[model samples]
Target: MSGDASHRPLDLRSDTVTRPDETMRAAMAAAEVGDDILDGDPTVRALEEKAAEILGTEATLWVPSGTMGNLIALTVHLRPGDRFLAPALAHVVEFELGGWASFAGGVPHALPWSAGPGRVSPASVRASVPPSQPYDALRDRLLCLENTHNAAGGTVTGPGEHRAVTATAKEAGLLVHLDGARIWNAAVSLDVQPAELTWGVDSVLACLSKGLCAPMGSVLGGSAEFVRAARRLRKMVGGAVRQGGVMAAAGLVALSRIELLRNDHSNARVLASGLRDLGWEAASPETNIVLARVTDAERRVSELHRMGILATTISGAVRFVTHADLSEKDIQEVIWRISSMSP
Candidate 1:
């Protein structure tokens, strides 16, 4: 969403578009790095420990991307040809390029959002589990959940709801994996610790490159045994990095500023409120992502792009994500520009 040196487009596509601030850049430059796979990068280990503590897990492994983190979790949890359940339109279902099927060798069974947008009911999950069937039936091995679910305009599943769903899966003998890429936002919005929402899940992945605004990295956390296994799989997938502390250092800085996500959430609410005032059906955002229903998402998005506001379409809705790089003034300007658009 860059225009020129003088006119930078207001990018609302996703939080991933955020650039590392000077603090992050300085940390990266001064990072003490080493061979992550051979000798173990000291800073990478520090990040893993910090993330694990935040998520209340026994251990954690640093991966190059959230997709890779999810893949590693899938590989460890599912055997080849096993089936796993995820909410329909979940990032692992709609995004991730079918890595669950092709790479992880697991079947994806999409659960309807019966509880609400981007949420699945506990009863629905219980019903999805096959009865003590013959050996030929595909085994359901894992349940994947997303907090502040992306495609649903960043709707949050509260700690109680999270426990209910995961408890159901666990009772049915399924391991749970939480795609907690935006868990910090959810925590800030709910006024709870990030660990509260992750208590019942066996493993969770949190991204540093998204709202936290680190350069690039995600951490997967679980039991010491689970992470020990994931470390091997991470290396197998060519994710082994030597001197990875440069990025992990930025992650440390990002973690320190986790509370700052409240600003992004506040800005998103303002953006949605403005869109609603313009006669668009914009839902009140629960976090930093806003979804406005439109007759033609592609056309609306294109129009916005031309007006120097970058946006994307998700499930026939215009998607806007607020992030660290955006300010309250930028939100106001976006509303003004959209209001001036031709009908």
Candidate 2:
């Protein structure tokens, strides 16, 4: 369960590397299949329904990836030439390759927030709305947010913050969309229901591929009408899989195991604390991901690889993610390997 031999495969690279286990494979094999594009796969439907009920949304739709889910939601919520506001570090703004503009013809306006590590606040949202620009005048239709903001080292947006931000958007007659790809991580860290973070948002997209241990897939949830529109967009974007019960089966297993995400958070904290003890500058992880700064980022990564560990370097920091497959022993091994390297 390590990484490729060229790299020593402790694989702290990303949570996406997690593989489905025997239970997931068995579920896929036993899943009841149907033509999803036409009649709807029974397994897919069940997963969608379960997600909707869990998130307290009216309905949900399964898409191939969180990118597709977010894109589809944007397409449904906005018209061509429309604009949306989000934190400068938002995944949709920084990581998604301007898909909002290319696919949905929507414009993204960056809202300034506390730099380094912080969530967008109500005051920031209110101030970002141009004084001369009325909600309708600017053609801005949505306010997008990410929980466990990835680029910020997995910081969780609390319920109060979420309510404040969304409420401000609503006052300005704008809809709120949550890019909650790591929301389950936030829920586990905050000891709140996932619905608490998503309660007032117009639409939400949560990924099964990240911390949930699903092979691949994401679910978009909102009003029934919005989900219906997203389904059409899904097909238009070539994201409609004919018989996706195979993936949906794994998603079902992910839902059942989501409650265990706290373990990943605990492991991340332990790893971060250990790295700090080694004289590395590591942030206290609020969820499954940790970012540690080393003197020579590339050399440290190479050294870690030589010592049988895998990780990613971003903005001069090495990123590590913990998942169901990673245990406390693995975390200890990672700490030992990195500590063995001299500054």
Candidate 3:
């Protein structure tokens, strides 16, 4: 059965697998273009404008990746030798290869968030920023956060928590940057408009490639002056692309189809519930990613591969992300395969 099943492809690796659908392909094929580096590409400009409006910001810039978008935003917000703060599990702190230190020339003060689901408390922020002995003078230049925090099984931080955190950051005169790679999923799961969650944030970087199904792109949004500065930082980091509208066309389709993300979140919950039923421990997913723990995680991953299911094991936890292309049937099949596995 496993051999025969190998002929079928049920990729649950990550939402990043979602390819451009027919409409996206059509848009890309017909997209008008210009030298975005010199004279901004019209399609890229439209996508940036749409993203800015959605994020409730004054302006936006299109970048090639969420990493680039975040790096540019951080560099724009902080100068060399400055310091930024975030939860220890934040993508920029844990996953971005220390770009904040290397590219932005800033130090990271990774404060601990709530353990299981990984939430940062305002008190933690306050304590992390208060002057300590030795008088090191580590000024807090920026506060970074992630929505539907990836390493936390896509947990959604409520708007109240967001406001409290941002309020603290603002009171301290620190600029806040949101790593909203899955902001759309967070909004859908929390049943709030995206803008409401981002209203207090100084700047935001959201990815078009993740849950939105764009082939590749991310938008950095903030005040007009901030975005202008980020644009220069993007070019300085070699992120400027010529005639990039081909990718931006797919991003347009992603924005128009973003409402469907609720379906992905629903499937994620279903997947987590099923894993629980199989006696596998899974975090309660509030968005489109689920984290499950299996005994001898490395061995379990190999077994899953034999069953033709793919997932990532992060520190003994396997991550399963739902995407637009995965059907309910595919989700069920994934659950069934896991059920048959013995630790």
lDDT scores for all predictions? 0.92, 0.85, 0.85
Q: Write the per-residue lDDT of candidate 1 for residues 1-343, one digit (tens) a residue.
A: 1224215589999999999988889999999999998889999999999999999999999999999999999989989899999998999878998888877899999999999999999999999996697898999999999998999989999999999999999999999999998999889999999999898788999999999999799999999999999999999998889999999999999999999999999999999999888888998999999999989999999989987899999999999999999999888888888887653
Model 2 scores a C-alpha lDDT of 0.85
User: What digit string (tens of lDDT, one per residue) describes model 2 on residues 220-263?
Assistant: 99999898889888989999997899899999999998888988
The predictions' CA RMSDs to the true structure, in order, are: 2.2, 2.7, 1.8
lDDT of 3 by residue, 205-267 (tens): 889998889989899999999988998888898989999999999999999877899889888
Which stretches in model 3 have alpha-carbon errors above 4 Å? 1-3, 131-136
Q: TM per model?
A: 0.97, 0.94, 0.95
| TM-score of candidate 1 to 2 decimals | 0.97
Task: Note the residue pairs that clash in candidate 2.
Answer: 3-9
Stretches of candidate 2 exceeding 4 Å from the true structure: 1-8, 115-118, 134-137
Clashing pairs in 3: none
**Candidate 1's error at 291, in angstroms?**
0.3
Which one wins on lDDT?
Answer: 1
